[model samples]
Target chain A: MRICFYPGCSYASTAGYKESTEAVCQKLGIELVVIPDWNCCGATVMFGENKLRATALAARHFALTQAMGFEEIVTGCNACYATLGKAARLLNEDAELFIKTKDVLQALGLTLDRIPKIRHLFEILTKAMPDAPSERYRSLSVGAYYGCQLTRPHQFLDKGGYPEILETFLERIGFAVTDHSARTQCCGASHAVIYKDECRNLSARIIREISDKGAQIITTICPLCQFNLDQAQTGDLTPRIPVTYFTQLAGLALGLSATSLGMNKLLVSAEKVISRP
Target chain B: MNKASKPNPFTSISDIATINACIQCGTCSGSCPLSDQMDHAPRELFALIREGEYDMALKSNTPWFCVSCYACMVRCPKEIPVTDLMYAFKEIITRKRTAPKNQKMPDMYRAFSRIIKAKGRITESYVMALYGVKHPLDALKNIPLAVKMILRKRLEPKALSVSDPESFARLFELTEKSEDKA
Candidate 1:
């Protein structure tokens, strides 16, 4: 099936997300058509900087998808997904805000009919493969970290606390999903890049919780979570547990090569975890 | 007429009225991950809003440290959209230019906005450089991590510009004009 894809700026640079997502989608026969000349969703900051600009920025993408005659636009990044979703919610509910956004779009020779359905790649991938996977994880313990944006403010795919979509998806794919308390908690989000010390302290709490749950490796859907958790490793010389993208795990089950999926680019080496393949 | 024409920072925010709907339940504060670090937790923050302490609410480090997790909103009994409220506070702080003293967030947001404004995309490498230019000491401390990322070939140092820059530029210009009108 063909669908409009918003790669969300971070997709290309964040090692395995794009690569593994492509490999898995190709295998599953999901054709990802990139939206032409898409701009950044401005993540969480833009709305804070200027609400008008942030709404228009997100609505611009909605207009592009609607202009293409498609109703659903799939996003890869958690922040992008949340931003687009929030903009859609606001534009529909607030008439004044909607008119203002529409005015801005009209100024640019565009019109936002409405914010189209914004979905994360994980939801799409999970629905795409309802059948049982032929492969199994044997005994690898994986902690599925959803982070903040993906399942927040508006439990888009699942509940805010203890969301089971990713966990169930992991189990269905035959991996042993570790139960952890930090499933929907914040991974310091993008603030880690700014307030390094403070964000790190918060991130430390997450890593500690996930590790204490006996997870050998942590699997996350957001790039920032993967970066923060991986970099949030303690200074002491204890072995670093691998923090990997869910796409990489799915790609592995689909029998894709690790190198092709950009597995080597992960900070905490995946050698010990995926070396089995 | 001049006072009427003045850009009231409060009205620019889409849903400032929601602050009144906040029930003052401590759920927002209880749910916040960084409550201890915040000067006024979400509960107290909303109380400040009702009390008309906009300056205090904006000055507090709470919004800066929010992480935009939305946990509070999800768990709030009033469904107050606590996180979005925090985002509104963020906008107020940024627009009013009162981002507390020595906040890395306001500057980072500015640099981040500057980069996105120019290129229409987020290139982490360039953002890092731009941030380093602003905070040289912090930049120096992160060099080792930078080198590590570079060695991993994750640094696509070349910035990616949007296909048509004129339209994107016009969008910003129109947005600013709307702000002026507001």
Candidate 2:
């Protein structure tokens, strides 16, 4: 019930991912020890700039996690999870890159003696929370959005194309899960910021698909996915499904108040849905 | 390490070998969600590379259009690591400064990299501001959303730096030195 948390760069700024995660973890009796002085995971931008630097950026976190005496590093963002995971895989497979990264870390008075396992916050929560169902959220139907980068290119958790882990978790926790084809679809990732019109269409497609499947609300595991989906709904997107983090729903199931879970941070507003029955 | 023995950090032979194995079966193109936006689909990019048309491959908007969803990478019939190959293409484009004149993605990447290089962390507002300097109209369009985010306390204009600034600075310097040697 303890984890070494890496909140990533956007954790604090992304729509209650931080607040809900903290509240949910605290209630679940999970101790979150944040890595001290952790840097950015460089997301998808760094590897395109320089492979060695990108690997070192993520490796720095690995060393920090080891310093904290933890074998795994848990992060909430899909980009961070994939970035760190990709770095770890590269270090393990490529000796030259590993040595180069070690040299970089050594210069900073740190050592990459062990590569820590990169875990998604969702994985940790599912493992820690008991499967005891509660009737509090049984009436609320959710469209589980996994975003890209969680399971794809690394099928450790579930099938990449159509993942059901989120649904299984939701059903186990008492919320009704909706079946949708947009589960592993891309939310335009970071490109949504630069290419607004195009990325809006991309995010809108996912939202439309999930809404058409009769989902009352959409739940996202990644902050960027939630942000893109929520913001895209602003301009003429129909149904206006509230995009809430998985943590927010889990917090509600744990008997936390809506305001305490940061549900108010959502743009489309989950008020009506959660306030029902 | 000797020059011949040392792998090219930018684009390794193994990476090319992986792309070389691509059968041009179009599974990658079909699987890609943003293929419609790219000038050349993932399958076509691989074909271009195999034909020694490196310039065309680098110049294509295909790589920049990649959202790194890895749908192509996972579903490729030949397992060509399509996503990573896209990253490799971006690196080559960046190093060569050959990004198309109309492409804003390279500039966006530059802005993002600059922030992380300075503060050891990214401030979303700062990134948007920096990127905005180059594209005022795009930034202008986001004002409404930005205001809403600010009101919700989700976007902060102030930047956040790592707790240990000195070591963070040193890490970059040493990494750059190592890259220079490579």
Candidate 3:
């Protein structure tokens, strides 16, 4: 099956997300056609700054993906997936906003005919990955942190307060998904660099929240979330739970080797998770 | 530390409504992720808003880094809409140079604005490549990591694949028209 893909910015810079995601897809035999000239999903700042401009910016990509003959657009970045998803819903809900955005697009000689379905990579894997195991590991409890981007803004997908997409994917791979409050909490996101101490404190809250709930491993789809949570700990009081890309875990469960899964590049060191019997 | 007493910041508005709704129970500050890092509590943000101290309210860093997490709104006993107030403050603060001194973030915003002004959309590859160009050494550091993900299909190069370039360009023209009209 083929789906239009938007990789966003962080996928190119993150540790092993790119490699492991490709390997897993190849193993699963799904062809991911990257959308030609794909652009940013307008993350949070865009909407915060200019709703009209941000909606128009995000809607353009959706329109392009639909034009490319794909009903669904799979996004690699959580923020992008969420932003596009939110924008699509907003445009659909607010006619005036839609017209304004449409007008903005029309001058460019394009129109947002429809909003394509936006799916996170994890959502795709859960639906697309065949049940037959490519590999197996001892049963482990994993924490699925969906972050604020996916679940919030409430206008898109499953549920607003609690989402089951990530958990469902983990379960499909034969691992147990843990229930935790931190699943939707802010990990201090883009502020990681500007407000390191604040970010670390907030990230620590999430790590402790997940760990307290008994999740042995933490898996996510956002690179910034992964980086902040993975690097928060200094000496003592560190959870030391390995933070991994959902793709890497899928690769491992799909029979790909550890190196092929990009295990070496993880900042938090997934050796703890990978070394498990 | 000046913990003895505090005024409400939200009271100055024509509506003293949401101000009285606050219980002064510190629940808003308790739920805020950045509260611990701030010099004044979010509850204090409300306090300042009530006292007509708009300058003090707008000058604080407490409003800039909010993460927009609606925990306070969710748990607020009075349904005070603390997050919305914070958004208003953010808009006010954001316009007045109250943003965190993000050396790269401003560049990021400038780049984003340029993309919207140029093509009406942000090209992921273009943004990354440009970001890399601006920070060559740092971008270079990401190369080895990028190369690894690219081979795995997790990371894609900007030149690899794109949507219809013609249609994409037309979209940019539309944004310029809107700007002219605006």
- Best of the candidates, DockQ: 1
Write candidate 3's Cα lDDT for A79-102 as tens digits. 787778768877787787788887
Write down the lDDT that model 1 would get.
0.80
**Candidate of highest lDDT:** 2
Which ranges in model 2 have alpha carbons more than 4 Å from their true place?
B1-13, B177-182
Residue-level lDDT of model 2, residues B1-182, one tens digit each, is: 54345433335434767876777789999988789899999889777666666667767999899999999988987778889878877877777788898998888888998888889999988888899999888788889998999889888767999876766877667766444211
**DockQ of each two-chain model:** 0.60, 0.59, 0.21
Off by over 4 Å in 3: A132-135, A155-165, A177-181, A208-215, A234-239, B1-29, B38-60, B70-182
lDDT per residue for candidate 2 within A1-277, as digits (tens), equals: 8899999988998778888999989988998999998899999998887888989999999888887899999999988999999999999998888888998888888878989888999998998777744687887889999999889788888998878999999989889988988898888988888788787778888999999998999999998999989988875865699999999989888888888888888899899988892
- Candidate 2, clashing residue pairs? none
lDDT by candidate, in order shown: 0.80, 0.85, 0.67
A190-238 per-residue lDDT for model 1 (tens digits):
7777667766767777777877888888899988888888877858623
Higher-scoring candidate on TM-score, 2 or 3: 2
Residue B164 of candidate 1: its Cα lDDT?
A: 81
Interface RMSD of the candidates, in order: 2.2, 2.1, 5.3
lDDT: the better of candidates 1 and 3: 1
Candidate 1 wrong stretches, greater than 4 Å:
A130-132, A237-239, B1-14, B21-23, B180-182
